[model samples]
Target: MDNILMKNEKFLEKQRTYTYTGYNLTIHPHKTPEVYIDFFEFILKEKFFLSTGFRTYHLALHDLNYLDVNNKLTGLYGSLVRYENLLPSQFIDLNTGKTPEDLKLNIASNIKYKPTFFHFIFFPENHKIIFELENERSTISYNVVLQFFKKILDSDKFKVKFTSGEVHTLTSFKRVNSILKNKKLKHIEFLVSRPNPDIFGDLVDETISEYLEDQKAKNMTLTLTAQDGKYLDLNDNTEKLGVAAAENGEVKAVIENSNNRTEEISTKKFPLNHPQIFGKSVTIRNRLLMAAEKLLPKNKISR
Candidate 1:
């Protein structure tokens, strides 16, 4: 055999993580369809400049493209940029070892700026919108973005309120409690695993502990129902245990009440994210649009 030496090497590719938070947007009832279209069109060309103390910030929309074919428009895609005009006080002379104050800098003009970006896709037919923030390194938050949106709508004299709420990662217990708050819980079904002496601390009752040791059961399915709208009052410890299991995704629960409504509590944090390769061929906008396309359902739009 020839002396052929092959060396194995490990390579790590640079990847960007993208997190898109889902939202439901409802146009104000008073605003007509024409008015809504006009408002969005106006914002496409508008640049919002706001100042906080000495720092001036800019918010603007860019890359306004429509998913239209043969004069039928269905969706819109764009990016929101939030940047800050760096004040003279933020600069320092590296070679001269002098700060802005030492150099007697009194001008209000700024020459440098830092920016944060958020990409969004909107379906006008269904009022479904998705937003992906820049990166985790950016200090800007969704609340700040929401404020800018509201400010622009107000400044543009859009009368109707634009309300947006996120679809969050919520626990089943939280959802159940929220929907049935102050209402009678008529039925409930949940699964509980056999108690582990090492894990269940005070949660495992004396009877359950003995039962687990003797029977060696793996799990149990409990279904409780009240008669004629009566409430099933669960003990505090049992409820706590169920809730803990639900948070961990170990419990499957179904509860029905007279006051049950289709709703979920929204949060600002995006709990889901995906990693992708960042390279020359794939731009940030392209990556965002690609991610947004996967979230749309075929029959989501009514028309």
Candidate 2:
């Protein structure tokens, strides 16, 4: 009994009970924790909440039920087709060029139809669905999925287009802002995957303009193997981005990852971007080049 107890009498005197009101809880984002703004609705509902989302650590909160003391919680995980009713229409109407008033551009339109990597954070008290989308670039799909939220939710605010077909600013921006801040938590994966093909290329365009604007954005480099008709006009876009970056002392030189098959780099400038050519994937143009009777110098300047 030498391992016995020495008790402080003060420890026996008090018991504290913690109450988790709908207001008391919040949907903590995966990465950025500093942002803890409460949404208009309470997330804790008595019944089960529903979702069809990419699994992540933050999502555990829903299944676990706010780390309950009694060890009981509720959630509903359904198939992609199952949640059609939950999804908003006009959500993926970017290509249509015609967006409905109630429906925001859908996130699904990007990168073809793949498994969606998003979640719906439920606020039980307010009966609101805090749709949390992960903004990522580590993979092609990550960026594409984020397109949904990015297009609809502006920085720390919901850029809601009104019902009367007229855009209004009646709602308090701050309340919505908190929701955005919490949603934009840390990058889910180690690095955001580059979007595929069309989507991937667009990201290169966005990266220079958005995140790297403040740096010495000189001599930026782009790497990709483009087929003859792949419509690679990044040179023009990069030049524009470079100039803007320069105004802020960023992005000087540019290099394309063309990697050698046919397209050649033609440029000479310190703050220059040279498209480094890479061999393109197997394509009709590539087959013809392979079948050529006489070898044409790649520097033939076809374009």
Candidate 3:
């Protein structure tokens, strides 16, 4: 961790993640939105968003504007996500002497990792999108998490990882930073030991295909570590989990011989909304998101 991050004691305690929960959204567009990336930049250029209700966020090519797939407003990527009270607050850009708007609302956390959703993914190097989902239970949804990664593969944006001049590395936060900066999925508990002998290869391949679909890539090696069990079916549940991920993607089939087993970790995926439960445990954290967002602009964290 950077010394600056260390100095921010709270950052380390939370593993560089502050709690952000509410009925937020992780918008997955079925069709590209009419407002393209360039257009988004043009609109927000020279402006800033005083964040209103989310905890954390990051940006990709643009400072704070990420264009969702096809540019449509919002859609659930996978079957489900960490469907807790997590939500991201919204804000918009305003001049130094002006105030910004606050946009906070409920958004279902249903995007999950699955096999069937590989149809429209675009994996750009360092830009693989993920679709983790939450369910009725309080626990996180690992199956939905798989669906999230699968959706990223469908986006065809994964190629950005190897687009010449695009230096890549697993060690550097560059790759995953966009997701984090954009508040796509924070509190990601990266596995200490990755399990490479796993069959999630299909998921990775799917991401590669979408990323490299229209254009040629630098043919770079995506430096990924198969964390022993973070995204694996640790309870010898690969076949079952794989089937679930696939089903969530609209693949209405079960694991034919899903007996094959593997070890993976469990991750919780879901969209966040500020003022989302405001449970006793997260009251202080909620205050932080609201206060920081007030400093920034609402609607600034748009993808």
Candidate 4:
């Protein structure tokens, strides 16, 4: 009995490590109210609980626990539950050593399901979320997360529109810098849409702003490239470039190194917000709070 217990403990220890990815979510209310209702308050008042079904699985949020930072409410730790029904065809009779025949089987008798849990944390203050790729089984994909949120919000009568971007860090930038070191900038492109005023304040040029207003254009694209092997030193505007690349637009640049090797670099290549790993030693609530500590701005962390 002791030997069996020891093997089970070893197996669980090996399965503890998990990777979590982060994303920023901006929520919009249905109407332009004088004061926007904070998400945390809204959830509390509404007693929000997501329960919905998709093609193959039913998804729901379960075992939710809220966290407070410095006496202020901030985020929550929860488990996403996915339930998939088992089909009769998946079963094989031991005596026959063959698959179960559909005609001979009763569909209602085969009403077995498997439930999976993917633990996650969300900080409403910054709208940052960290999702565990897996607990011990399959991964909850990015597309699934997006769709799940959209459906839940829609059911609650909240606006479902959201802008999502992968967080990148300076480490990702260092890799790009190494690849294009001493390279000549050959081409650059920027695609901008209805920029969020709160985040893109004063970043848009006067001329471009005027053009957008006058033309009432939904979006605009700008391109610049060096001619005759000339170097375009656009690095001087890194501040504006970073904002444009991250929030307002997608930025891409092509460069040619001295060895005649050309490579394409984009703002997307920068790894700003990297994934984090957690072992079983960390509790679900602490895992969520720790992720918030790392991603949330210092000033916002407390408040």
Candidate 4 is scored at a TM of: 0.58
Worst 10 residues of 3 by lDDT: 162-171
Best candidate, TM-score-wise? 4
lDDT of 3 by residue, 203-284 (tens): 5434433444334432322112234433312222322222222212211111112344422222122223122222233433
Total backbone collisions for each predicted model: 0, 58, 104, 6
Give the residue spans of candidate 3 off by over 4 A.
Answer: 1-137, 141-143, 152-215, 222-303
Global lDDT of model 1: 0.48
lDDT at 158, model 2: 31
Give the alpha carbon lDDT tens digit for every residue of 224-253 in model 4: 777775866555344344344444445667
| Every candidate's lDDT | 0.48, 0.24, 0.26, 0.53
Q: In lDDT terms, which candidate is top?
A: 4
Ten contiguous residues with the weakest lDDT in model 2 = 162-171
- What stretches of model 1 exceed 4 Å from their correct place? 1-14, 29-36, 51-57, 69-72, 87-112, 136-139, 160-280, 283-286, 293-303
Model 3 residue 234 lDDT score: 23
lDDT of 1 by residue, 115-182 (tens): 66677776655444567754545534444555655566455344433432112221323343432232
Residue 142 of model 1, lDDT score:
48
- Model 2 C-alpha lDDT per residue in residues 1-303, reported as the tens digit of each score: 333332443334343211110101112111221122122111222221233244321111222122132421221211111122224442455776654557743454222222333333322221212222221211112222223223323322332221110011111122222211222221111111111111113434346433433453322443333354443333444433322222222221212333523322111112111111212333322222232211111111111
